[model samples]
Target chain A: MLRFANPTLFLKLVRWLLPLAGGAGAVLLAWGLYLVFAVSPEDYQQGATVRIMYIHVPAAWLALSCYSLMALSSIGSLVWKHPLADVSAKALAPIGAAFTFLCLVTGALWGKPMWGTWWVWDARLTSVLVLFLVYCGIMALWTAFDDPARAARPVAILTLFGFINVPIVKFSVDWWNTLHQPASVFRMGGPSIDPSMLTPLFVMASGATALMLALHLAGMRTEIMRRRVRTLSQQLARQDGGS
Target chain B: MMDTPHAGYILASYLLAGVIVAGLVLLAVLDDRAQRKALARLEAQGLRRRSSGQTGEQ
Candidate 1:
């Protein structure tokens, strides 16, 4: 793992892993969607609306997972000062924001038909909104600084501060009385979902995870190249100034 | 499910997710190409990265 701290070595690894992850993501998503529509049974109450869960649940899970990843990378940036750590964290912001946005939108879509409203100020819902806002804030912070190196420490600090929301977002469903259902797939008593539905949900989650990984790798590669460009341009400026 | 009463909502959810995912992929790919091009242009201009040898072939 430490071997990956070198950006060049990391890029070499990404060259191979990116395509593999993207391919696996595509295949798994295709298979998962097939099962979602044709194989999984509808909820006795929600009917076809339950089909939305196939995507919603996975998006929700990924949103939380993405933040957790950012927090971990932020730690690396601050503690170990891993060179690729800030790059990894920076790259993940927009992707994590996208997933969080998807989760909210899908949840709203699912809500309208089932709850008869587009949104509510419930604990689970509101905390996720806060999570989305944090993602946006981190992205903005990355852009606020002209120098990537200068931005790294502050961004990592903000990320760690924002991580308080992760546990809040996860446990909100249980900690408070909310419309969102509590822990269907992950719980002390094991999953309450039928195997048929559970299978597709897990498959979709895996696919989304793979796709996120590919995107993050691509983002990191671009960031590394970007830093190099900045350095070269600075060097050119210095040379012109010297001459 | 397309014919179901809530099909529109279901469709919208999936469609929106698709669009967002596609947008992210496009951003990653385009940003990558742009940076690579900028690096090539800089190198062509006789500017070499200070750590060029250590970084290996990108």
Candidate 2:
């Protein structure tokens, strides 16, 4: 982990990792989609609409997981002041926001057909919505500062503070009466979902995780270059002024 | 599956997810290209980074 703190080494590593992750993601997603349509059976209660769970559940999972990654990166930024950690936290914000948006829209699409509505102000739904807003806020905070370094601490602080919503979003269904279902795939008693559906769901999730990693790696690489550009331009300006 | 009731909703969900994911991929790729271009232009102007000795191309 500490070795990766060096930006040059990180860039070299991502050069290979990005393609590997992207290729794996493409393959897994294709395989997962095939299983979703061909192998998984329709739910007795929800019928064809249950198919939405493959995409929706994975989006929700990734959204939460992305936030968790950001929060961990934020800790690295604040506690250790690691350079790559700051880049990671910055890079992940938009990706996390995108996934959260996917989760909400897909959840609404699933809800309308099955639950007879587009949305409900339930604990789970509302908390996820808050999570989306927090992502947006963190992105906004990033742009608010003129210097990326100046932005790092504030963004890290906001991220750590916003992490309160992650567990709330996860456990919201259990803690409150909500339209959202509680812990089907992950529960103390083991998965309530049948094996037929669970297989494709896990495949889709693994695919999504791979894709997210690819995007993060690319984002980090870009951010490192961006900082380099800033530094080079400043140096050029200084040389001109001194001349 | 297309004949299934509420298929439009399911299709819409998948379509939207595809669009968002593609958009993210596009953004990452474009940003990377742009930064690389900027760095190259600066380096071409003979303004090397102070730490250029320790690092390769940005």
Candidate 1 error regions (>4 Å): B54-56
Q: Scored by CA lDDT, what does every candidate get?
A: 0.91, 0.91
Chain B TM-score, one value per candidate, order as shown = 0.85, 0.83
Per-residue lDDT tens digits of candidate 2, residues B1-58? 5558889988898899899989999988788889888888887887776665754544
Model 1 docking tier (incorrect/acceptable/medium/high): high
Docking class of 2: medium
DockQ winner: 1
Clashes of each: 0, 0
DockQ in order: 0.83, 0.79
lDDT of 1 by residue, A150-241 (tens): 99999999999999999999899999999988988889989999898899999999999999999999999999999999999999898899
Please give the TM-score for the first chain of candidate 2. Answer: 0.98
* Tens-digit lDDT track of model 2 for A1-243: 668668887887887889999999999999999998888899999898898999999999999999999999999999999889989999999999999999999999999988999999999999999999999999999999989999999999999999999999999989999999998988889999999999999999999999999999999999889998899889999989999
- lDDT at A171, model 1: 91
